[model samples]
Target: MLLEVKNLNTYYGESHVLQDMALSVDEGELVALLGRNGMGKSTALKSIMGLVKPKSGTVRFKDKDIAGYPPYKVARAGIGYVPEERRIFPNLPVLDNLAIGIKGGKIDAGNPDAWTVDRVFKHFPALKARSGQKGSHLSGGEQQMLAIGRSLMGNPELIMVDEPTEGLAPFLVMEVRDMLKDINKVGVSILFVEHNLKVAMSLAHRLYLMGKACLAFTGTVEELDAQPEIRAKYLEV
Candidate 1:
């Protein structure tokens, strides 16, 4: 496994948000963490990124235990996170925002080729055109692209993206989905947290359904489509 998370738990003060969450991702695979709102999916991603400290559990990346490491340390462990909020620096130019997140280090021998600004721009040509434009001026789709581009500048081996399609137009959502597929084709393992079932089914090789702070289902897309009871019980609004 490129990334293995075992028995992970996290809390926000008095509230326990994640309970024994476990998942794994291998090189070149795109896995979906699917759930409705407020079901600990984003918290699981945060715990992996070290934005929210896990109370207990093991986060192993490339055979090294990285649980409880700080955010920068987690980033250094070859994990990159694109948050659902699209945390772009509004005053900064698009190119500069990406430049800010770039880190220099030796590339992992087993991972895909590292990402460069030019390479990321190729994946997102709209960002290329807006390179000199301020982030505050871009549309929601463009800002989301910049967010992903910035994370790629770090050259992470595993990427955890939260809600890449949220609030995007249907066309732009499809575009982002394709972009993620292209990224995976280049061998970066992906752990995607998304609420859009259609997008999730289209992009993910496997699906993990989360509920009440625990994993409720794990299966292929075809298997999930066949389980109407699972959908009605956990996914239907």
Candidate 2:
């Protein structure tokens, strides 16, 4: 497995946000975490990335315990994260945004497939045109692309994205989905939180549904289709 979480629990002050959460993403796999709002879907990704420290459990990445490690440490272990908000510097140009994500020695010069700013621009042609544009000046979809591109600048083995398609136009949604698929094709494992069932079903090799602070179900897309009750109760609006 590229990443694994077992019995993870996290708290936000007085309230428990995640309870006994467990999930894993194998190499070259695209795993989706599905759920409605307030069920710890985003929190799960945050915990694994060490953005929010887990109160307990084990997070093993590439066969080493990473739970409770600082966010930078988790990132140094070759994991990247793109928040739902797409937190790019509004005043910074696209190239500068991409440049800051570089982790000194992370990019292996010997690896032909390793990521670089030009590679990112090639993957996101729209971003290429806007390479000199300020982040706030780009459209929502472009910002999302920038966020993903910035993470790629880290040359991570796996990436965790939160609510990637929320509030996007249908075309933009498809664009984001295609970008993710292309990234996966290049051998980056992905663990993404998405509320859109159609996107999850169409994109993932496996799915984990969160409900009431824990994982309620996990299976293939066909298996999810086989259990409509689980979908209606946990996924449907």
Candidate 3:
């Protein structure tokens, strides 16, 4: 497994956010974590990335236990995280934003398949064209693209993206979906958190459904298609 979480429990102040949550992603697999808002999907990713300190759980990445490590440690261990908010430096140009994510100030010498600015631009041509534009000047889709591109510059083996196509137009949503597919095709594993069922069903190799802070279903896309009741109960609102 590239990533694993077992018996995970997390809290926010006094509020219980996750309970016995568990999931795994294999090498090079694109796994979708699906749920309505506040169902612990984002929390699960945060816990895995060490952005949230889980009260008790095992976040095992590459077979090493990394449950309580800090966020930087997690990133250096080859896990990239593109957060839900699309947090980019508002004043920084597109190229500069990408530059900030270069892991360890340079790609790991041990891993030659690392990404660079030119490589990132190749993947996101829109960003290349707007390299001189400040982050705040781009459209929503462009900002989302920059976020993913920036994460790629970190040379992570596995990338976790939250809400990649949340509020984009239909065309832009399709573009983002295809972009993710291409990213996966080039030997990067992806853990995606998405609300769009159409997008998830089309791209995911496997699916996990969350409800009330616990896993409700886990299977392939084909299996998910057969469980309309599960979808209606937890996903369709």
Candidate 4:
């Protein structure tokens, strides 16, 4: 497994947000997390990323325990996180934002596979043209692409994204969805939270549904399709 989280329990100022939550992601797998709003879907990702320290739980990546290690440490441990808000460096130009992801300034200048700024541009051509544009000046979809590109610069083995397509035009939604599919195709494992059932079913190899801070269901696309009641009860509002 590239990542394993077990018996995860987290709280937000005395409000219990996650209880015994468990999930896993293997190398190169695309995993989707589905749940309605306020069901702690974001909390689970935050806990794993060390953005919100869990009261008690396990967050293991690459066979090492990373629970409560802090966000920078988690990123250094081969996990990149893109929060729901798409926190880009609003004042920085797109190129500068991508530069920060070069962890410890250790990226080999000659490695082709390394996530150099040019590599990010090659993969996201739209961003290449906007290299000099500040993040705040970009369109919503452009911002999302920059955010993902910035994360990729870290050369992480896995990425945990929250609400990859929260607020955007329908066309942009499909574009971002396809972008994520292409990113996964390049061997970066993904665990993303999404409310769109169709998107989840289309992108994920497996699904995990959450409700009231607890895991309500886990299955493959075919299994989830066969069990419609699970969605009707836990997913449909």
Q: Write the per-residue lDDT of candidate 4 for residues 1-237, one digit (tens) a residue.
A: 999999999988879999999999999999999988899999999999988899898988999999999899999999999889998899999988888878886786676777888878877788999999999999888898898998998999999989988888888888889989998998899999998899899899999999788999998999999988898998863
Q: Would you list the C-alpha lDDT of every candidate in the order shown? A: 0.89, 0.92, 0.93, 0.90
Deviating ranges (above 4 Å) for candidate 2: 105-107
Model 4 ranges with Cα > 4 A deviation: none
Query: Which parts of model 1 are misplaced by more than 4 Å?
Result: 104-112
Candidate 2 structure quality by residue, lDDT tens digits, 11-55:
999889999999999999999999888999888888988889999
Q: Which consecutive 10 residues in model 2 have the weakest lDDT in total?
A: 104-113
Per-residue lDDT for 140 in model 4? Answer: 89
Q: What's model 2's TM-score?
A: 0.97
For each candidate, give its TM-score against the true structure: 0.95, 0.97, 0.97, 0.96
Instruction: Choose the strongest candidate by lDDT.
Output: 3
lDDT measured at residue 190 in model 4 versus the true structure, 0 to 100? 98
> Model 1 over residues 12-130: C-alpha lDDT tens digits?
99888899999999888899999878999999999999888999999999999999999999998889999999899999999788887787543334545767778899999988988
Clash count for each candidate, listed in order shown: 0, 0, 0, 0
Clashes of 1: 0
Error of 2 at 229 (Å): 0.9
